[model samples]
Target: MRLVATPFQRRPAPAFAIAVFLAITAFANPASAATPTQTQPRASVMTVAAHSQIDTRISGLHTRLQITAAQEELWQKVAQVMRDNAGTMDSLRQARTSQANNMSAVDDLKSYGQIADAHADGIRKLTPAFQALYDSMSDVQKKNADLIFQTDHHHAAKKG
Candidate 1:
C-alpha cells in the first residue's frame, strides 16, 4: 500500500473548515498586490520631511554663500531640475528598503549592489544640477558653497 505525505493525508473537520475559509477569502479578494499609496502614513510623512530638509539645507547654503539675485534665479532653474528628478530619489529609497528585506546569502549581496547602484545613479542624475550651480558660482565662492552644502555631515554636526 502506498502512503501519501502528511500534508496530503486526510484532514480533520477543523482543518477542512480552515481550508474552505482560505479558499473563500482568496476568491473574494483576488487582488493581493497593494499600491504604493497603501504603505504606512508615517513613512510617507517621513519622505516629505526628508525632501523638506533637503530644501531647507539648500536654502541655508544660499544664505551661507551669500548667493546673488542672479545666482538665486539660476538656482531656481537648477531647483526645477531637481524637483523633476525627484522620482529618482524615491527609487533610491525603495532600493534601500528592498536591500533591507532580502535576507538570503546571495540575495543580500545582490540587494546591496542594487542599493549602491541606485545611489550612484541618483548622483549621476543630479550631476547636471550640481554643474549648473557650480557654473553660476564665482571661483572664490565655489569652494565655500561646496563646504556649506556638504549634506553628508551637515545634520551630524548640528549640536542640538
Candidate 2:
C-alpha cells in the first residue's frame, strides 16, 4: 500500500513533527525530578523577578493615579514602615530555614515559634498604619492602591 499526501498535507508534515517533538520533550520526564531544596535558588530568583515586576507595576499605578497630597503623605509613611519591617520579615525567614537545618539537633521549637509570632505581631501592628493610609485615599488613589496591593499580594500568595 502506498500513501500519498496532497500539497496541503505535505506542507503540514514538518510542522506536525515539530509539534510532536516539542510535546515529547515537554512531558517525557520524571514526575518528581527535583526536590524543593535543590530548586531553592531557582525559586529565590523567581521571587526576585516577581518582586521587580510588582515594584514596576506599583510605580506605574502611582503615576497613572496621580496621588493626592494626603494620599502621598500616608503612602510615604506606609513605605517607611514597610522598609523598616522588611528586615524583620527576612530575619524570620532565615530563622525558619535555620531551624529546618537544625531540626534533629534542636529540641526547642519555642524560639522558632517566638520568631514567627513576632513577625505576625509586626504585621498586626502595621494594620493601623495600613488602614489609616487606605482610609485617607481618594477614590482614584484607592483604586490604584488596591490594584497595586492586590497584584503584589497575588505574587506573594503564589510564592507561599
Candidate 3:
C-alpha cells in the first residue's frame, strides 16, 4: 500500500519556513518503482525543487518576521541553521532513495527512524539560533512570529 499526501495536505504553504523545516520527514516510494533514466531526472528535479522551496521559505520567513537591522547578525545564524538542516535532510533523502529498491520492511522502518532523528537534530540545532532571534524581536514582532508559527503546525500535526 502507498502512503501519500505528506509535507502538506489541503493547507496552503506557511508564510514562514516552518512548513519547509518540518516537511523533510516524510517521503514516498515512487522512486523505487522508476526506471533508471526516470529516476535520475526525477532526483535531479527533486533537488532543484527542494532547494527552491528552501530558498523561498527562508525569504518568506525573513520578510514576515520583519527582522530589524539590529537583529541581522542573529538572523544570519538562524538562516544558516535552516540551510544546514535542509542540507542534512537532503542528504538523508538521497541515501534513502538510493537504497529504496533493496530495502526490507525493517530497513524501511529504520530509514524512517533516521529521517525522524534528522528532524529532531535539525530542531535541536535550530532552536537556540531561532530563540536568540526571537528573543531580540520587538513585542509586535513577537506577536507576529507567534501567530505565524502557531498556524503552520495545525496541518503538520494532523493524524491523517
The C-alpha TM-scores of every prediction are 0.51, 0.47, 0.73
Worst 10 residues of 1 by lDDT: 21-30
TM-score of 3: 0.73
| Comparing 1 and 2 on TM-score, the stronger one | 1
Q: Which stretches of candidate 1 lie over 4 Å from their true place?
A: 1-46, 80-87, 94-102, 149-160
Worst 10 residues of 2 by lDDT: 20-29
Which lDDT tens digits does candidate 1 get at residues 50-90? 45644564565567777788788777755544443333334
In the range 1-160, model 2's lDDT, one tens digit per residue, is 4465432121112211111110000000111323434312221332343344334544554566565675787656554444334333333334444444344322233333343344455466556766887787778777886776566556543432
Give me the candidate number with maximum TM-score: 3
Candidate 3, residue 139: how far the Cα is off, in Å: 0.7
lDDT of 2: 0.40
Local error of candidate 3 at residue 31 (angstroms): 19
lDDT (tens digit, per residue) of candidate 3 on 47-151: 665677777877888999999899999988887777666655665566666667777666566556555666676778788988999999999999999987777
lDDT of 3: 0.62
